[model samples]
Target chain A: MFFLRRSLATSATADALAIESDSGSPAKEFKIMSGVILSRPPIITPEQTAFSKAYYHYQSELYKRMSWTFPYWFYYPKGTLAENEYTRVQPKLNEKDPDVLFNRDRNSKQDVVFPPRSVQRETEESARIYAKIVPNPRTTIADEENNIRSLERKLDRTLYLIVKRDGESLEWSFPATTIESGENLESSSTRMLAQYGGEDMNIFLVSGTPALYYKDVYESDGKYEGAKIFYLKSRIFNGLFKPQKESGIVDYAWLTKEELSSYLDKQYWRKVAGALSKQ
Target chain B: MAFFKPSFGTDLRRQSTAFFQCRSLHSSAPQFKSPVSIVHPVHHRVRYKKSILHPKYQTLLTIPKWDPRSHLFKPQAVQPSRVKTHWETTLAPDLMLANYSHNELKLRGRKHQEWDGSSPYHVNRPLRSPAGNAMATPDILPRTFRTVPFVTSIWVNTFNHRAVTEHAERNIPSTVMIQQITGVKPAPAYSGVSIMQWRLRKERNVGAVVEIKGAKKDQFLATLVEVVMPRVKDFQGIANSSGDKFGNISFGLDPEGVRLFPEIEGNPDLWSGITGLNITFVTTAQTDPEARLLLSSLGVPFYGRERFHNVPNLDGTKQTRKKGVVYYENSQE
Candidate 1:
């Protein structure tokens, strides 16, 4: 115990610094920030090229032709309502006519034919089953007006949220916030987003770790170190963005990757090009 | 693949007599584009160029589908698949970022060891098994762009007790049921061991098994997640601890649940006592937790206590248990 005490005394040596810290140097201090790259995924299937359309058609045709003939008796028994409807609608092929080929050699047509409904009032299930479906228009009002803030503008491509700060001279960038002393990048980003972005939006941060990071330099009153921003990926499933008046966010717009290049500065876009989705 | 790839294929190996009843020698219409001509009973034997069979091509009797010069070579990706598009456009980037670890260490997999070679008997001896009762688990490789998980294939199986106790032909429905659901022909499953209590003999047909991959596998998954699972009454979802540690997550559907499939649901009367179906999603992930994450992201729900220990905890404590070490945590916390 006496030897240990002596050793401890000898080690202001090991535990304490031998020299004083230099406080007079003018080294820059970087301000850490977390940037959220919030994006809305495609809501609809993308338009196919001519080659793909033709290929799908050809494949479907091939499948239809190669498949075995459908078992008609299984669905339409001897004297069922479906059988009656089938018999009434579809006529039997004449055996005498050699030119009539669909029934004789190959039964390529396998789809069941239902009798046109006019005389009989069908049940709710049957009516719903045979109801003619009318799909909504692909282009919405948002697309026509060229609304950049509208989430519904681009239905097929991923749309990212870019914001302009309160000042008029400020540049366009993704929603970003300065990290607090004890806060991590993800939590700080989420907190800033919720504080300004309002509770209307339902967002899911993709991960805890940042996907990417960007470094910068600043010269204000002195040669100051600019912000070192870490980008965290997030996705908005469904909701509207309510930009707060006092939250320093002047305006916000949802833009595709292609449109982002034109809105954002060349330097900023260069650093962000790798993280943004092309589609 | 053989059907669509072959440009001039003679798939007339099994021509029904009724199909060949037409008394004409004229060729049929352009029914299937791949087949150049259909063989008739009149000309039962097909004649072809004898040069293909010659020893010139290094005696590669099998058709070289990869060779561009061969008729079997088909240009791939003629049509854009919905599943493929989703993976590329929406799923891939998000998954990569979500599964990324800030600081992960690469672990060496426990491999088979060699003898010290000190004795003379070690000359031609085989490598020894891994140490202890634990299996040679795969290396916990850090997640990277290329290491992201995906479903490689799906194993669909159905075992019928009637096939063993009753006549062996009872497994016919099982085979047909498996084929109907999977859209792929299945192979018969035979019992390896004889059970006296069950009256099952070795080599007896017990079930049917099919491994679905490529396009059909995606299609089956889509149907299961979208239509079948939603229709299942009071379903509790797949159990959280369902994987076999080797990244293959398996689950079974009761006969009623199996019948809920659109393929089987259409005609339930025909399949009165259909056996339950067991589906195993074989994935590229090396561990169970990673496999579970991939599956859950792909729309499969997990219920019960989720033990995501197989995957390296990135967000939370990140205290990964070392090999041969017992982990303890106070429940009071």
Candidate 2:
């Protein structure tokens, strides 16, 4: 009996040592719940470029609240109502010929409207282009496109600020869009970035819900109609009021994956990230 | 035999034995009967019964010996050494001790006065004195109150008076008193105010008025610890409502009635307009002249400053700053 007990103890000790020295990757890796994939050097064709310009001009009339010396223009489908849905409208739109305006006056396009020039160079240049990001293998093509566009907006802001600081000018070409199935969105974005521009660009993958919830009623003297009561169902989720379920509010807030973790929300995003990592 | 004086210096062991023997025998006749009982004398035998001595009295009974080492005392050696050793052998030998001297001193110095060293472990206790008492001093210091200047602007509320009152009362105090008090808990400051202005479709020359009634003079002053003055949302030329209307809280002087809190006699505008109030209480004096003078001059009217409201257009078009407070309008493409 003594020998048997001794043998068991030694085996248990060996197992513990093996576990300690295994050097396998951490049982779980850090993952953001909301996945944001970024890409650049957008898959812009000549036709798409014309559409983008037309769409930009059309929306600018309403949202811009101002007219520029150089006319603001964009293309959109004839009947679309959404203000910023340029991608939806651009492909099916047309523009009045610039020839009419030019013939009426007589000035070159560059002479009529020139972008800000760099002191160091005659013309502005793009900093870099073409980035791809793969969020999770399960990420849908629609969601990936949305995330990429959002990332593009963020990058635009950042680069604008950077280039402006260096006393340089910048302009971005129309971003290209495509749906690659069952591929890594992040790695794909990176590869695209490398091919079109270069890989020195800062890349990030973020997972988050796109919605933000604020206590509008609390802030706005109860005049805010959007505030809805939410009932706590369990640790992972809350059920919003039935009346508000259709108001595009699934949770009290739309948070990035990191924020969800900080908020002690479910580790659903981590699982998604893990599945993505396998892919 | 030679006559010899007793030296009185005997072996400690022998003296204790002899002294105890005489006392045990006289204590009681029954106790002397047994050798074991006599040697070990039953506890509480009361060989010499006397009243119990207090600790101070007992301590006083023993005199400290005078030794030459008293002059050699040094404070550095008086502190105990704090070296720790690992008997479990789990910790590494080369691991440096976490030098916690600064932390210990900080904790000890910051400890509240009520913390008693008698307990083996320290427990948090409420401060015996007011939290501010630590900074109170007999010396008089300059009393200053900071006021944030606000531009005249209109506020639109889609709710009625009751909802407005409840909401304003909840959020206003923190914004109001953040400059003065610490740890402000929500209370009933909002209960006293009567909401006077309610317009659904935007009226002319009509302003929102919040009147705090029966307010103890310094009560409002107490709320301004870390005041957050709301930014005036800018709009174009004339608001849908005039400067006389919209949102501005008037105190001491009513929106309709003009009384200057006995501090001002010359300034006529004191009866109306947006005036910021900030004053420190040395001992709650009701009347301050400078505060009144400052408040009275607020609505003197910004003459010629109206031209600055126009935003220059890039297309050589005149884009005037319109009336009413503007919300965020991002022109992002």
Candidate 3:
């Protein structure tokens, strides 16, 4: 019993030391220190292989829906502030003159105090592609990646469209839609853009990637239990932003990054940062 | 008449004897026959009053003869009972006359409706009535009064004396403690005011605070109400007067009370010294009473006026009621 206890204690200490050493030292150093030994790889069973395949399959499906990429437009324009066009000239008074001192009371009574004009912060000119995730089951991972690469190559030539909601506040969001049956990711994205930005607008995919993955549990018990959104970056090749009213878009703005930051939430900024960091 | 009434001792003995006799009789015998059988008499019947019809009035039987040639044929315009006043025509006319236009009043109302003190957009304007006069009236019912009050946020503030004493002692432990208790990261609180004697400087890191909301707030409140509060010794419940006028209530807990929390007590090694916590509960109730009611429903016990003292009657007689202790005398005995 004493020998068994000693062996157990040694094994526990070894495990703890192994964990500590694993974190502190590099794997190569640890291997060299421990004296490297070559051994045959363990034989994997058919069941294990199948289980791993199934796990990957589930992960790929989640990846397809969750991964999103949007084009980051970085445009900073340098320009002097427009002179206060509404500034009015005031009558000057000389403090050294005796007459000015005699008329001080009258001047004080005639003083008309106008509220100070609000100072507007100068903003930089930059634009961002408001891309949303639209999952396409038909498109393979390789095909999606290839499409995004193709889109990235055409980024400079494309003119992206902005969609806005028709309301007092003029809320804006990206043109996003789910991939319909038999539609690929590229086609679905183009369709959503065309539907919101009008068919006249010559829009092309600038770049596309599974940039952001957001899990949305719309219904817990339904067949489509949850949805993953994949954001794809796109830009307009040529055409003006003519918002389709039928699709609930009333207005659009070609704003800079600074201006866009004021309009978008913190989450959007975080997403932008993530996309930019990848680049 | 006083002498005729039985003495107290004799009356007690009589009642006791009667009770014992009744008990003894029940134990002495079990009757074969059924006891207290209820009977219905065959002749018993309920007779409702019969209604008698009366002749209709002569005037009701005949309709007035219509004459096309009469002056009644010419329709006369009826005057309106209530005229549209200027006050009715304009939306909140008194407010408009007082330089508060309809737009301004609406803006203020909207601001108040969405007012959560933690938000930077909250405007600190006094609540006013439709007449443009500041509403000094207490307990004004909100337009959207709900049965259940919503907890806006739970703010936890604590000053770390250990940090002050040992400059090397950072707020790491305090931050960890707060995180463990609230399940959210705590923000470091800086001293806004400086005190020369206390060696405190403005913007000096003195403590940490965490504002909990949503599901986490509910969970923290449940732990506070169910586990921590019950374990505290000599707890007389929270006072009703501990609230800001705008339905926010802040209460301080001593080091002992803080120690009573399961998170702190369960893992003593995790926390070396107990720090007093000031927990402020921001609620959506307009008045203190409403907030108190809301908190009480959420399992926070409140101390009533009678909780502390047993006052004498106006006649200078000693009241039988005792403070802090409940007595239940068995009347059967």
Candidate 4:
């Protein structure tokens, strides 16, 4: 049964695990670390291109035309004052006219205009339903100020959490910590995340399995020949990162994929790029 | 009056016989049983048209399904879908992340075991019915991009007892109501069993069922979530224990709840004498929890205690939230 158990995963990390000893010596004992790629997915739909906007508008118009006709008789019964008022505003189509052929062709392109009801006549529910609503601006204060640390910025792209360690001079990396003896990747990553990033958060680890692993070797050292770091995916649904002063994290940033590339080392970016979502 | 009387009865008898081309019915008349005419199966293409086989269609050897040249082509309505757009932009990634399992193994459901072949009798014996369970549940396929849970279709049906007790045509209003809502005509359902107490017989028309797919399915879901559900008085969220062993979930709405639907609400008079609606959501998810997750993300709330399956979170724990559980939060920060 143990031999029959075949892993369903064909992940790049799984393949990387096989090639670990290919670089380092067979007897080399490597240090294991756990890292989390805490990310905030897009809040809004990506900004539409001009072509997409025009196309959607065209499609919407066509869709409206194909939709069911507004039943004037249902709402405004025949010979009622409301029905008379509704019909009076619209152009009367003559079936005998050359332009008008089918019943659908008559006023199908235009929406039925209805007479406005007096505020006094309207019920509170009807008034609430009919009230106009305006949407807030897409760009927030964080975006306006170009605040990389704030989660509010980049409303339409996947923003990742990268931290600057106290000792590291220029290296900005995903929150990671060395694995203690006998500790697994997921538990270590969760501990590292809450310690480095603040515990005041509702972030979820995507999976217990590590998404990617990075290995480095020190040829001069015999006892511990290399270091192995495994990255786990996590998502911050709600909450802000307050860097723990005791955790030795100097600074933190919430960045999109393109921005992360500039802050992360080129070699590290190559390994981590595939793990993050494009959007 | 006897025809032998040679009076007005004789004239009526002759006329009746001439028209009927059979002996007149009387107390002494031998009963006549008409022979049934049997027609053999005919060899012909149903609704066939010779013009379709013309040379004009020669260029359509590999025409796409949406192409006019294809025989099965239906013009796809280009509507700006709200749910689909939301799914692509937001829900899809979130679900993928939420559903991610650590090296997930495809779970095999109950299946019939092979014969042990220990004896001659066992060699050819029919496979034993699936070891523990009588029914075979579907395999729980590992989550992948293509296999992510989505609403395939929505089945909305309502049975009217009046159709069976009264005339079969009494179900027309329900049929029309469903058609108005779905834009697709529903097929009539029939009674499967005879019930003497209810005056129900086999083959009796019971009600109608409408299955809306693609864009219409999403529209109906959107309407239910946004408009109808909120208007239903004293409405509790869908109960936790509602799904079939498979991924499909069903819930019933009272007649009042049905009346709240915009199609019927617009003209209550037209949709009169209707019963409650039983709505089922068919999803691609392999299990109930996954299907619930998909629906909950789409703004369908669920209530009651639920045992979550493998919802591993940070802090090295598997958590479940009972009461009204919301899978998605569209909080703008």
Q: List residue ranges in candidate 4 displaced over 4 A.
A: A1-28, A63-70, A92-110, A180-187, A216-226, B1-65, B68-77, B89-143, B162-170, B180-184, B226-236, B259-274, B303-333
lDDT of 3 by residue, A22-49 (tens): 4665322111001000011111111225
lDDT values for all models: 0.72, 0.24, 0.46, 0.71
What TM-score would each prediction reach against the true structure? 0.77, 0.13, 0.29, 0.71
Winner on DockQ (2 vs 4): 4
Clashes found in each candidate (C-alpha, N, C closer than 3 A): 0, 54, 17, 0
Chain A only: TM-score per candidate: 0.81, 0.15, 0.35, 0.80
Model 2 stretches astray by more than 4 angstroms: A1-279, B1-122, B129-333
Q: DockQ of candidate 3?
A: 0.01
lDDT of 2 by residue, A15-65 (tens): 122122256643321111111222121111112257665665554432222
Ranking by DockQ: 4, 1, 2, 3
The C-alpha stretches of model 3 lying farther than 4 A from their native spots are: A1-279, B1-148, B304-333
User: What is candidate 2's lDDT per residue for B105-189, written digit by digit as tens?
Assistant: 1111112346555775556655454233442212111222211112222111111233343444333422322211221222322
Provide chain B TM-scores across all predictions: 0.74, 0.16, 0.49, 0.72
Model-by-model DockQ, in order: 0.19, 0.01, 0.01, 0.22
- Name the TM-score of candidate 4: 0.71
Q: Largest lDDT belongs to which candidate?
A: 1
lDDT of 4 by residue, B226-276 (tens): 998888898888988888746788999888988888878866765668688
